[model samples]
Target chain A: MRKTFITAILLVLAAFTARAQTQEPEMADALRANGKIYVVVTVLATIFAGIIIFLVRLDRKMTKIEKNN
Target chain B: MRTWWWKILCILLVGYTVIAGFLIPVPRLDILNETIRNLYFHVPMWFTMIALFTASGIYAIKYLRSGRLQDDIYSAHYAITGIAFSVYGMLTGMEWAKFTWGEAWSNDPKQLGSAMCMLIYFAYLVLRNGLKDEEKRAKISAVYNIFAYALMIPLIFILPRMVDSLHPGNGGNPAFKQYDLDSNMRLVFYPAVTGWMLLGFWMATLRIRLHLYRFKKENSFAFENN
Candidate 1:
């Protein structure tokens, strides 16, 4: 079961890598487009994800403090 | 978050929207002519919906993992926001279709996929309302929200892409494809996406804040009585 799960994940990663490779030459073309919006979307998404991470950490600290109490 | 930042951000966003929204692209299709302006509204609405729902689905997964009520609240708002986007997309598509296709609506794969997605989330809301217990509401709603959304992305984005339709950038049309981005259009297009995404984030944060306030108030009330 574990082997199968590992293999499945590996296959998924391989497909993603392959997809990225296929998109590479187009990367030059994509870069040419000056897709400022994509950058903005990506940055905003990262910030939101960062907030989630921070919240998780804060929750953990709160839990520990409560346990001490 | 408790500062004047939101008000400032909203003012800037609305200002940008008015300026960019009217500066409409010189119509790419001769037949469509100025009809291309529909894209400003159509694309942004659809993108916002997708972003909001994605945020919701993420929350659903987290809620399931940690059994947190706050996660459930965020998930619900996200689902509703996704529905709002789907509605805007459908309506905008209908108008565009009427102009371009000479018929307002058709059983297109993309349309059907969107309808299906909206229905699933609507049912999710109904499912949540069915349960009275807080824990059960969180558990059942979280499970269904996750399941429905897992099915939603592929069925709407992926499956529809596999089939042809009147829509551009789908099936085999490169006209609307990302690769077709002309240098000129990219100037406006990319920022348009950013602006729309920012707006979507803005809405989600508003919804989340309202939820937090309600949750805090309710728990305090519960604690007081206890």
Candidate 2:
């Protein structure tokens, strides 16, 4: 009976450790590893750059209009 | 060239925000997981809106004091830009909430408060359009803008804190600062806010310039006749 109780406690401890290992929060580790994350970063940066260019052009046009007036 | 410096800074900072916001390491937590990055993007929209609205309110006060139609134009354009930012804030918030909070419209206190705040500002626009006379519209709307700004403070910032709210930094929930807004995130977050605020200001200035141009063109005959 003593041996059986010891075995049961050991099994529970092992299960707890296993659960803890698996319980680590999910993140985009796989994407980072494969470097697909950079693709997303590049896409966003390109879009932002495009917007900046548009704003700059508009500002120049406005300046020309103001000068003419 | 000197005047264009801030616009250049705005572009650089926002460009940095886009690149670093994605690549930078962030704290990992359940549920919030990757969506935690939304803090950099989503939260800045509200900050920009608040900044624009504050500018609008100040211009409104200036209009009241000086009775200058130019001040009214500045105030109106600022408010319009502010409303645009608020709409972006609301939509991004809803998208984030749908995935995290399990519903797009959870009727969260902060959400309801901001919605009410938007409606009040929308009424400001409606009030301006309802009148045809320029002076009357400016005077009445200036007063209303002051009232709207006063009400917005309590609705968006104070009321959410007074009640139980799911939003961070409100009610019982700890703000990001207390838990997960680590030093790393702050590096990108602060710049993101500055960049977005500048961008909103730039857009408002563009509208103000356009309006001013039109106003000048319309009144040029008066100046020539004089």
Candidate 3:
């Protein structure tokens, strides 16, 4: 599972870089130049990751309680 | 974990959405510019919110028919989840509006309608908290849930389109079918909607399980005391 996850991440990165090389569409080009878009992406990813991790931990706690019962 | 495939699918689809939404090419249009990409993010919130509330309404009907506590729990959680999505939708929409529409609150018909819909659901939450008796709470809230949802459909969907509004596909603004028909935006749009809806369901399920667990524990404790 870990291996597949790494591979998927790599594939997405590869696809991203490939697209970057092609004709870029009309976007916030200046924003992309300074790599600030990554800031937005990182913030979004972190928020979601935090939420998912919290939910998973809650699920685990519930499971332990159920087991005890 | 029992039905994990769809959960995994949700993660993948949303991950794709975040990445492609920023980097992917979008059709260039006047006024919207790069903000057009908000379509993938903003629009899906409304779709997911509607989907969740629909489920809430269905469960409300089931609770009324079966008189089952679990059904009421499910109905309540779904409404809560729907409210979460709607709140997020409104905030994001306001942000998008500030950039495009020149004001945060433009008195748009769609905006007013959605605000009223959100308040109705908020009232549902308050109603639930006011009742102390479980059975009474369940029955009354179920009736309110059904009624609120009936009003919600027209408020968000129908009433917005009937009047002049800054929102797209309403009044004189071009609809998605006209503007987005030729773009590849639909590729990500559909998946984004599905992914967000699934995520909302996932959250609701977790809440439902947590509620059920607490109820069971309380029952067992009461049994021990007896």
Number of backbone collisions per candidate, in order? 1, 0, 0
- Model 1 clashing-pair count: 1
Q: Which whole-number lDDT from 0 to 100 does residue B137 have in model 2? A: 98
Clashing pairs in 3: none
Distance from true location, Cα of B59 in model 3, Å:
1.0
Task: Residues A4-38, candidate 2: write the lDDT tens digits.
Answer: 99999999999998998789889999999999999
For candidate 1, what is the TM-score?
A: 0.70
lDDT per prediction?
0.69, 0.94, 0.87
B83-123: candidate 2 lDDT, tens digit per residue? 99999999999999998889999999999999999999999
Q: Model 1: per-residue lDDT, tens digit, B144-195?
A: 8778878988877787789997677667755554544456555556566666
Tell how far residue B78 is off in model 2, in angstroms. Answer: 0.5
Candidate 1 DockQ score? 0.02
Q: What fraction of the true Cα-Cα contacts (under 8 Å, chains A to B) does candidate 2 also have?
A: 0.77
Q: Interface RMSD of the predictions, in order shown? A: 13.8, 1.7, 3.4
DockQ of predictions, in order shown: 0.02, 0.54, 0.19
Highest lDDT: which candidate? 2
Q: How well does model 3 score by local distance difference test?
A: 0.87
lDDT of 3 at B146: 93
> In angstroms, how far off is B155's CA in candidate 1?
1.7
All candidates: TM-score = 0.70, 0.92, 0.86
lDDT of 1 at B11: 40
